[model samples]
Target: MAFRLARNRALIAPAKSALGAIPRTALFYSTSSKPASSGQPQASEAETHFGFQTVKESLKAGKVAEVFSSVASSYDVMNDAMSFGIHRLWKDHFVRSLNPGRKSGGSPMAILDVAGGTGDIAFRMLDHADKINGDRETTVICADINADMLKEGEKRAQQQGYISTNRISFRVENAETLDSIPDNSVDLYTISFGIRNVTRIPMALKAAHRVLKPGGVFACLEFSKVSPAPLDAIYQQYSFSIIPLMGQLIAGDRDSYQYLVESIKKFPTQQEFAVMIKEAGFMNVGKGYEELTFGVASIWKGVKPLDSK
Candidate 1:
């Protein structure tokens, strides 16, 4: 069945009718049972965890790079298969919550979707804005560290008729240092399911802060801590025992999926991450995040103070 971007910004899979969409997963392999820290290597240690295995912090980026490069082509298909298209719903809500696409003062709105290698979020933002304004003045910069992923994103953009329209662009950029993006230029900075993989979460958050204009918003959607003892227990069983199996069946890449699961475990909890956002100089830190899907994933938001610039 083919999937199309629905008017609600959800990815609706081809079905007999509009009402047949239902999400469906299981995996096993994470070694840690508790929620994680920001996952940056401490100053005293030069090593970091790579899916329950320790590796030199300097080498983690390359390893993560290899994983994405291997899966870039199959990324979209696997995402649908694994999540049963539920991720599309999460993404839709993420963009809608921001709704930062309306034209302000007859100028094109700037959105920097960090680590948006495949352009899903960027495309949604463009569609959201244009549907409202009926203009092509909304542009998105889809940035990632992996060229292979960016290439795939560009191909998809072309498929969606985004080529030569100036509605979308791709860039190879590091999250911790957006050297090419000038300070206070971007209106919205978004990172979905990407921040946990960074070598330094604080540095990345700082960089996000630097690039956004005062009053610009920072948004992230990533796996988060789940609650209620019974549900957490079931989720652990499914993620650890079934997700790796799904990875092997869908992409023939079990290890990469295992790493992804482990990274989720190692990511900071919602409250902890909210604090980090505040530390990076964002305001409304207390009300910055919303839990989605009962915390299997979450949306975190913070804004630069309008008085800062």
Candidate 2:
């Protein structure tokens, strides 16, 4: 009986020894196979359009900043030369369309104009709200990614007497995140000829939706595809040929203007952009876009739902 018991003990000893030989971590954790790679480029290293050229998505913002900085001082002059002063009329119409300001016995609107660093749209919005709506309490926050552009806006604001009125302010803000802006704080969001320069249009639209109050409006004025092939051809010729030359002559920055024209061409069409706005969780009216000047430009608006969280 003793010999048999000793034999059993010997067998148990080997089993215990084997168990003790195993690593503690191995005993507690199992090895896992590596996840299968999607075989696509990483998002940070993704490619995005910079005018006619494709560039790293991470670098597009820097490139756009350079372009805007180069043209900051002469931006309005170049706009006048390129559009033959018709841009002024377009802007007037755009501001009038929104009809910004205070309602009777209602709170004044809080406006955010993204990428409007030159103060053109900001001034128009404030003017419309002040002069037309008689809303002295309304205020505008003009944001742009470029500091030089914002300086130009501040200069214009000072010149226009808006600085003293305290109705308009400027900030250096990227359209994609707008980190300085609080969520659900804005009553009206406007981006005029600016969204295309954004590295990610969808992200900008989402940010816009995030910042706007429930029932707040999102309005965009942008260059778009022209109707009628003959007219389009004429417009295309002028855009490609004369615009860059005008940029060189007026702004002394040919590359920047060339890039601007290319960026405009790269922008999504009116219908496509409207779909993007709707995808950002905004409610649209009709097709959600209005073509201006034979579709040379377009106006798009969307409203955040009152029931939205």
Candidate 3:
């Protein structure tokens, strides 16, 4: 009986040794076939569009930042060349739509222009309010995520005499989360030709809703689909071929231009995007969006409800 018990102990020792040899981490992940990778566990990287490429969601923002940084100096020039200055007319209409400060309670209306690179929309808002309403009190905060783009905007603002009056200010702020902006403080929120580039469109929409005061307005002007077959064919060709060529010639950055062109195609249609705005708790439901220039671009507006929770 002693000899038999000793023999069983010898066998158990080898089994215990083998169990000790297994990695501690392996024991935790024993149910899975593969081990958990080293370093920060890969983030649950849900994919988002970066033009035509299906990139890891984590990498899209960096790529977009690179594109904007590279093209910041040349962006305005390319816009003029690609659209033949027709973009100006669109922007003029956009500013006119808001009639900003014209009807706001006789106080300095606070305008938050998100992703407003180079202050194009903000400048328009300030200029119109100054000229039309003689509203020296109105102020604009031109917010952009890209520093290089914002720097360029500040330089332009200096040249245009907007800096001295203090009517316009610049902040480097992300669209997905306007971290520094307080709740229900902004009087008007405008994003023009910029919404499609956002990594999370819904988050940006929510941010817009969050920042606006009760009865404040939210407006977005963005590229849209051309529904007519013949027009779409022409538009597609121009965007895919001509726009990239212009980028190469003007900005010396063909890849960035190509990405921007492709991004325009991936954006939602006017009506679909309007529904998204409503989902973010904006009022006017289905009645706030308008298509322009044969659906090449669109304007969407929503007012925060006065009695919102």
The segments of candidate 1 whose C-alpha lies over 4 angstroms from its true place after superposition are 1-45, 103-106
* lDDT-based ranking: 2, 3, 1
The true-versus-predicted C-alpha distance at residue 151 of model 3, in Å, is 0.8
lDDT (10s digit) by residue, model 2, range 1-309: 000100101000000001111111200111121111224446667788999999877778888888988999998888887776777877887787777887665667788889888889988988887888798767778888888888898888778887777677777777888876778778889999999999889999999999887878898989999877887888889899999988888888889989999999999988899899999999886678877777877888898888887
RMSD of 3: 23.4
Which residue window of length 10 is worst by lDDT in model 1?
19-28
* Residue-wise C-alpha lDDT for candidate 1, range 175-264, written one tens digit per residue: 888766778777778999999988778989999999887777788988898776777778778788888888898888888888888998
Query: Where in model 3 is the C-alpha error above 4 Å?
Result: 1-43, 102-105
Q: What Cα-based lDDT does every candidate model obtain?
A: 0.74, 0.77, 0.75
Clashing pairs in 3: none
TM-score of 3: 0.85
Clashes of 1: 12
TM-score of 2: 0.85
